[model samples]
Target: MKKIKIGIIGGTGGIGRWFAQYFQKEGLEVWVSGRRSGPDLPTMARECPVVIVSVPIAATLSVIEQIGPLMPEEALLTDFTSLKAEPVRAMLRASSCEVIGLHPLFGPEAKTLAGHNVVVCPARSRKWLPFVLDLFRKGRARIIETTPEKHDEWMAQVQVLNHLNTIAMGLALKRSGFQLAELLPVATPAFEAKVEWMKKIFGPNAGLYAQIITHNPFVEDVFENYQESLRELKKWIRRRDDEGLRKRIEQAGLFPAVRMKEE
Candidate 1:
């Protein structure tokens, strides 16, 4: 039985490179395409039975538009975009190929997929869905099957809101003219850890983070809710209401394991 060849567009580095190497290790023939190197986009589409778009957020849709029409009907066309809905729609609209939206919930530098979550939005076919899921399972990744819409909705809080708070803290510190070097000496363990995490956001992939925050449709509501919470917290702090602050803290802790029941 001949194994299907997989082509990863933009697979020269980062998650694309990771996927290219990972899939190769899983015994699949993998080809790659990148901006300045590797195989060309049209060539990958025409050659491989499965084409994975592993480009950056800003370039994803345009890449999809380019290769979507070139893919064969039996090809599995998927993407590694953080935000799902738009890319999935683009793939479906532009191609008759099997479409899936995948978002690996960890960075490219992760050593292993063990215990990591991989969200799979199987928008189109059953042909490649099982193959993809089985591969992730073999890698010890937790496979989360979901719709593109629901995935984007949750990512509003997961990625956008989380990045928002991190960026906001870093900005607040900057605006205060507080020297990070001076603060390090007095920083607690949690503060030190948070500072390191904030460095990741401020360091690389700034554009990717920005796109995730701005492009997500549900993010506006997330931002509103976050601001409202901050304002409420400010009111309690301004009044020096010890009991109000304590109650608020306790209320938040009370629902650690609570899940919303489907309505």
Candidate 2:
């Protein structure tokens, strides 16, 4: 049996490069297209039976529209975008090819798909869906099947919420009189680890993190709820009301976990 050729647009770097290398490691024929190198998108679309858009979230839709139409009817038009809804919709609108929106929960730096969550929002498919599900299963990835809208909603709570919290922490530390050098000597190991994690967004990955925080439609709702929770915490802290603070913690189901640890 002849295996399908997979073409990854934006395969020069980041997650795209990761997939390009990973798929080759799995013994599939792979072709890549990038801004300055490799075969062009139109050529890839025409040649490869599986076309994946692994571009940044900001450019995902445009790339999808570009490559989707060129794909053969039997080809799979897919993306690796974090937020799924828009990309999936754009792919469906652009072509008659089988469309499946994939969001690998972990970053490109991950060593394996094993134990990691890979959300598969199969928007349109008969031929491609089973192949992808089997591929991830063989890789030992934990497959999560959901609608594109639901996937984006979950990301709003997970990625957006987590990144926003870290951003706030980083900003707060910057506003503090102490610099990293000053903090390091007095900082606990956990604190230092957290600062290191925070540095990722503050550095070269800043644009990617910014898109994760800003581009998703559901993030605004997460922000509103976060602000509401913060306001409540501040009110209790300002009042120096120990009982109120304890009540808030208990309400969040924290005390039971602490109690479990002690028992």
Candidate 3:
């Protein structure tokens, strides 16, 4: 029997490393390549039946362009990018293989796929969808299948805006001239929680967060809406329009959303 092989282009760290370990546990021949080690793209494209692009968001498309043409038609080409639209489009344009845009909606620190989402965008994937879906299903992931464009549209708010808010708070604290130790000593519980969350996400993963903010095609609109909201809040604060602010806040509280029950 021929052994199954999978190659991860950026499998040395982050989610790539996590998946590498996962596949290793599953008894598949896992080949990992970094910038300077392991098998190169051409070799992987020829030998591996499933090739995953797991590089940084900034480097994903170029890597796809480089190896997409070398892939066998029966192989699966997929990515672990947060935003899906451009990567999915690039894979379709560059590869003849079955393409899937997979975004695991969690970080590498996750222990299990118990409740987190794994968004699957099946682009030109007829021969490999079952293989791809079964892999995640076995991992106990909650799968949400959608189009590449739709995935990115949702991520604009879920990822870009959420990161924007964290960066805003972090930058604001940096500009406030007080040391973190000083601020934390006097901060309310709510304020301290936000500060800690901001540091946890913004400190080490700044590049990834920046790429998420800048790369999404929908970010311009998100920025516009954020600024508009800030302007309205600023106006209310300047005028001491407590009633106006209260009413606006109350109205926003009623914004249409199917609020999820707490887990």
**Distance from true location, Cα of 66 in model 1, Å:** 0.7
Q: For model 3, how does the per-residue alpha-carbon lDDT over 146-166 read when each residue is reduced to its tens digit? A: 999999999999999998998
Worst 10 residues of 3 by lDDT: 254-263
Off by over 4 Å in 3: 1-3, 254-263
Model 3's C-alpha root-mean-square deviation from the true structure amounts to 3.0
lDDT of 1 by residue, 108-148 (tens): 88998899999999999868999999989999999999999
TM-scores of the candidates are: 0.95, 0.95, 0.93
Instruction: Show pairs that collide, candidate 3.
Output: none
* 2 versus 3: better TM-score goes to: 2
Assess the local accuracy of residue 96 in candidate 1 as a C-alpha lDDT between 0 and 100.
93
Better of 2 and 3 by lDDT: 3
Q: Given candidate 1, what's the lDDT at residue 105?
A: 95
User: Candidate 3 overall Cα lDDT vs. reference?
Assistant: 0.90
Model 1 lowest lDDT segment of ten: 254-263
